[model samples]
Target: MNKKVVVVTGAGGVLCSTLAQAFAKEGHLVAVLDLNQEAAVNVANAIVGAGGTAMGVMANVLEKDSLEAARKTIHSTFGPCDILVNGAGGNHPLGTTSKPYLEPQDLNSTVDGFKSFFDLDSAGIQFTFNLNFIGTLLPTQVFARDMVNREGCSILNISSMNAFTPLTKIPAYSGAKAAVSNFTQWLAVHFSKVGIRVNALAPGFFLTEQNRALLTEPDGSLTQRGQTIIDQTPMGKFGSPEDLVSTTLWLSGEGASFITGIVVPVDGGFSAFSGV
Candidate 1:
């Protein structure tokens, strides 16, 4: 089997780390890039320990220079990246409102650290938007330069269910993810002639480290918000990270050579459900 070079940003995270490991298991030379060098090394070391080829490198998806540096390192280490996964994105507390909807008297009342839509921090909104949208964009700009004419080279952007519809209390995250989905289609169309297929994976309600506290309690029980998600989802449960692996592998491989510019949902029917 020909070993392809696969690069996954945010590979240190629970979900992306799984992707990195899976790619390595399939005999691809996986480059696990993350902002945290130690966390990335842990994931890469695990893959190497299992006798798969992988390397961990520090990379900030929001920074072009950081991505360019990482790209150079990847090219020198494992050759040009045949597959790029832009998985660096997350929401912030300050970007979220304390309540789903604003109340009449609530607007007049004063409470310490009570963040409402009116009080949402500008810096927080900017950070969240940049993290999810620009984070995906900058990395693609740096990596896709190498993939332009390469055979079987593709890009996968990680979007979210919020891209399809706005979720309450998380306007910033929802908007950012929407941008990611839109960018996927734009890139796919622009790069179609170059043979670089660009697509997006809009994963629904996966209980990852980034949202663990919000979704689950320390007692291993689902929070009220989490239960509401499960109730809305047609499958009546949260999706496992492994559930997305097959689709991701298929999309990244030649098996889905004709698939591009689409946002494949791996949300256990979450996206298909309506509150009927």
Candidate 2:
């Protein structure tokens, strides 16, 4: 395997951190980029402690200047990025509805903190859209320049099952992920001439710190929403961070050289079931 410099945005997060470590394990130089400096450094340090080469970088995916700064640091430390993983994305509470369905009285409801579809904050929606879609786009713009015309270079985006089927109460997140999936295809075609392969992984529900409270109770039991997700999923459970490692590695390596413009679903059959 070629030892490439792999830059993973949001590497501090559970899923992306796993991807970062996996790349390092394969002898690639890893740039663990995150908005939180401490989290990024911790993950990078852990990889180094395990005998892998990695560096932590602070970057905000939504800001072009921040990403450019990160790219400069990565270039100086590990050379140009050969593999870019756009993993910096998440949902905001204001972009989500308090309930799955709006009631007849919701328009006139006086309940505290009640948010319906009509009540969704515009700022929250924009933030979600920018974080997921623009977050992926900006990173590619900044890091993909190094990959142009380079052999074995690739880009991996973290899409979500919500892209295939919209999840209730989180229209902003679902729509944003859908945009990501669409952009993956667009980017794959756009980068084809440059020999840089672009693809996305539409993951199913994974139990990460970002969604732990929504999925599980304090006692480790499933919440109502989590139970619904499990029942809908053919696998009957939430996915683990480790569950995504192999697919991510496969997509990043030469094994998937011929694969591009495709969004692989790693959702354990969640996308296949129709709830019949």
Best by lDDT: 2
Writing each residue's lDDT as its tens digit, candidate 1 over 197-254 gives: 9998999998888888988999989998998999999988888889889989999999
**Model 2: per-residue lDDT, tens digit, 1-276?**
679999999999999999999999999999999999999999999999999999999999999999999999988888998999999999999999989998899999889999989999999999999999999999999999999988999999999999998999999999999999999999999999999999999999999988999999999999999998999889888888889989998898899999998999988788999889
Per-model TM-score versus the true fold: 0.98, 0.98
Tell me model 2's lDDT, rounded to 2 decimals. 0.94
| Cα RMSD for candidates in order | 0.9, 0.8
Off by over 4 Å in 2: none
Model 1: colliding residue pairs: none
Candidate 1 residue 194 Cα shift, in angstroms, is: 0.5
Give the CA lDDT, 0 to 100, for residue 40 in model 2.
100
